[model samples]
Target chain A: MSVSVSANEVADAPQEARERTILGLTADAWLRILMPLAIGVIALGGWEWAVRANGVPSYILPGPIEVGQTLVRDWHTLSISLWITLQITFAALFVAALLGLALAVLFAQSRVIELSLFPYAVILQVTPVVAIAPLIIIWVDDIRIALLICAWIVAFFPILSNTTLGLNSADHNLQDLFRLYRASRWQVLMRLRLPTAMPYFLGGLRISGGLALIGAIVAEFVAGTGGRASGLAYRILESGYNLQIPRMFAALVLISLTGIAIFLAMTLVSHLALRHWHESAMKERR
Target chain B: MLAGVKAGPPVVTLDGVVKRYANGTLAVQGVDMAIGQGDFVSLLGPSGCGKSTVLRMVAGLIAPTAGRIGMAAGGEATGDVGFVFQEPTLMPWSNTLKNVMLPLRLAGMNRGEAADRAAAALAEVGLKGFEKAYPRALSGGMKMRVSIARALVTKPRLLLMDEPFAALDEITRHRLNNDLLTLWQAERFTAIFVTHSVFESVYLSRRIVVMAARPGRVVEDIEVNAAYPRGEVFRTSAEYAAHCREVSDALHRAMGE
Candidate 1:
């Protein structure tokens, strides 16, 4: 048994010493970036090759090159649409964050408010944004405000629930310590509950960041197709009607990129905020 | 003279302190005890004895369901009463200095003065170089030291500790026990410590109140005549052993026959 243990240790020694890296990136980080890149390249290459080999019509199936060329050709129009979509997404996210955080704090402070209002939050979350968009677009005079409201509705609840959970999660012993110090209600809320809720609120913000984009795109589809200033969703619909399939693909690419940008931005914000104290952001020690 | 026989004026007095939870569970019944000025007393009992309940009541963390507690009027002027919980309840988000500064800040002291006193308190607990270190960076013993530093920062007249060193290893526990005794000697605050360890109770307390569970109340009060400034030598000596045995006997009796 001792001989086998020694042999096992010898086998593990080299494994421990081997510091895996790819072009100065740690192996884990390299794999995370490269794996998705490889998949995207392979998928796009296959689609381009298959369309060329099959002699598919440009209107039916545009090659990746055609899509790339169309994206460059319609840069000015698509860029404007991209900017509009991004503004609505971010504005809605900002409003959701403020409203959700304020409501969560209120709920945390009073059980009566939480009980009365929490069910409505759940109700709002369960109802689909797609179903509510047409009515919202028709009722509101300003199209942008109507779109903002729809996006805010979809992005609001996660922040509320997660912040509430985090607020309630302060250690019981620490709460007693606060009481022992005779900390005023405001002091406890500002110093303790707010800090405790920070990581949870950031987590919810990341989720809401993506959802806000989706809600914006979906709302724009309803509003723009109903006759309004075009965001990327409307650009795609217009391209489809004109049989500019490559431009539609370019518009879709821009929308996907916008979603990715929002996600990355939120992630960077979370990392910056939590790196000093939270376990989630801390670097692991060997 | 016996240790508690020469007790000073009562710093804390509990008269028939009964604690009944809203769930209809009686935690402790008729707990009548008085802590004199500058006393080191231990509420020694097994788990579920409600010794913690009594300490919490004294700290004003909770109210007694059926009785009154009186404190010396001048005790409040010393500072806020300190409470060190079983776990090292230092705020994870704050550094050692900030954690210790919490009480003084709550009392509305300016940041500069509070920082000076907090740093001094941390130094008193042998955490001189660790003022900027967070609780997560410290060991269990060091974390408990930070907790102690925070408790004593207010220059409290009374300190209530609930098994503060019970989670530490034997070596750390003994070192902390010695350190605590030293601090108590220097500061001379009235302290009520709750612990289940018989050896710990004997080693630390001037008067050990052995308690029974199930509507907890004091079963026996044993005074340790062992001299002040107890160390490792005293821990192994005949006098300490004798005191330990007597306390152990009281504890066993407190538990059952």
Candidate 2:
């Protein structure tokens, strides 16, 4: 009787999961891609209608068409600002990864070092970057370096904590096997601890990517009136001063898109790295 | 080679070994035994019988609280000791071949030679075509085979197994038992296996040491006079059932005590 019940379940499971598709895409897949886009279009259409009907001025809330026209007209200026912001974000993220990984390894080796220094990292994370931007800019002659420092500060802690946890989480039995074989310290770290830490490090990377972008933009906002060469935040400030609100909206749109792209790239990297072995990343079998 | 006529001296000896945890619990007490080279011995008991504790002591993984635990100088000089835990306990990131090569690599052997030996070990465990498969992709039985291959890759003279097949189903357990006997005959390594199953111990070991719980210690030792290369025919024979009954009865009596 149990055998026949299991057979019935086995036969029925795939039919329910085999959802129909529109064109080449499954129903669920197409809905996921199209639903967000449809909502965005309808919301914008409503805003445009309401603005024209009520004769609301562009200074208050620019319609979607005006924002689009401003984006195309100011493409050169806006694209340059976008590139500058992205450059700082990527630089800060790279430095954070290298420093966080090195410090985590050191901490794994010695409790004394971790205990003495880890509190400072926590303090840096809790204190807002805006509060320290002016002091950093005054100390550092190069505005780019100041921006990178602020971004690196925001992005370094997650990688440190997560990688430390992963390193310490190596299976106890495997460690015993290594001891039985008389493995060297370097061998145990490279073969067991590092691989155990990869998935966690990637998780931290995804979060740090977004945080780095936020740091760069916030620092740029603080340095807007003082620095000569600046990022998109400076453009927003300039547009607000001149009451070119449409151009400000266009700059905001570009910034959001860039943040989304960074996040998606990090997600792709994490998926590729852990897809084979880690349970968190493996694909579910039916 | 001479059908188990005391092939060599005792490879490992425990003289009144005692283990008391830091939390003030006495896990094992006053256990004394000697295992000869190439002999198959089973430490059989119920749960909390400290069978696994004894196995761990033999592997030199934990210190005995009192008395002397000694290894033959010949075996210690070669540094060849293999261990298989209840779980497979493999590194998830590495493939089967790399996992098997870990011990040799730690011993300062170069990658080329280690890879050759690792592949040979995988073949010996019937995992030849799966050298590149990751641990997550393999089934439970296959993963256990890889763990066994890793343990055997260094040609260890002493192998300590702690209920290695306890998690497997009955069919797979029987097949692995047969395969393990083959490996034992071919390699002639001293095996000290820990198990809670009476029939399993009687079928697998030449001598079964029955243990009791509540401050665990050995109570009895029963010898199986079965011949070498015992197979399915013996498993179905009356003699095998009689041996199993005897061991089971001993185990029941120990538990009652």
Question: What value does the lDDT take at residue A202 in candidate 1?
Answer: 98
Return the TM-score for candidate 2, rounded to 2 decimals.
0.93
By TM-score, the best candidate is 2
Q: Which stretches of candidate 1 lie over 4 Å from their true place?
A: A1-24, A225-229, B1-7, B76-79
Candidate 1, residues A25-119, lDDT tens digits: the string is: 78878888889999999999999999999999999989999999999999998888888888999999999999999999999999999999999
User: Model 2, A69-158: lDDT tens per residue?
Assistant: 999999988998889999999999999999999999998889999999999989998999999988998999888999999999999999
lDDT of every predicted structure (CA atoms)? 0.86, 0.86
| CAPRI class assigned to model 1 | incorrect
TM-score of chain B of each: 0.96, 0.96
lDDT of 2 by residue, B17-135 (tens): 99998998788999999988888999999999899999888887888999888898866642488889899999888888999988888898899999999998888877777788788
List-wise, what DockQ does each model earn?
0.20, 0.29
What are the chain A TM-scores for all the models, listed individually? 0.90, 0.90
Global Cα lDDT for candidate 1: 0.86
Q: Which regions of candidate 2 deviate over 4 angstroms?
A: A1-27, A225-228, B1-7, B77-79
- Residues forming the 10-long window of minimal summed lDDT in candidate 1 chain B: B1-10
TM-score of each: 0.93, 0.93
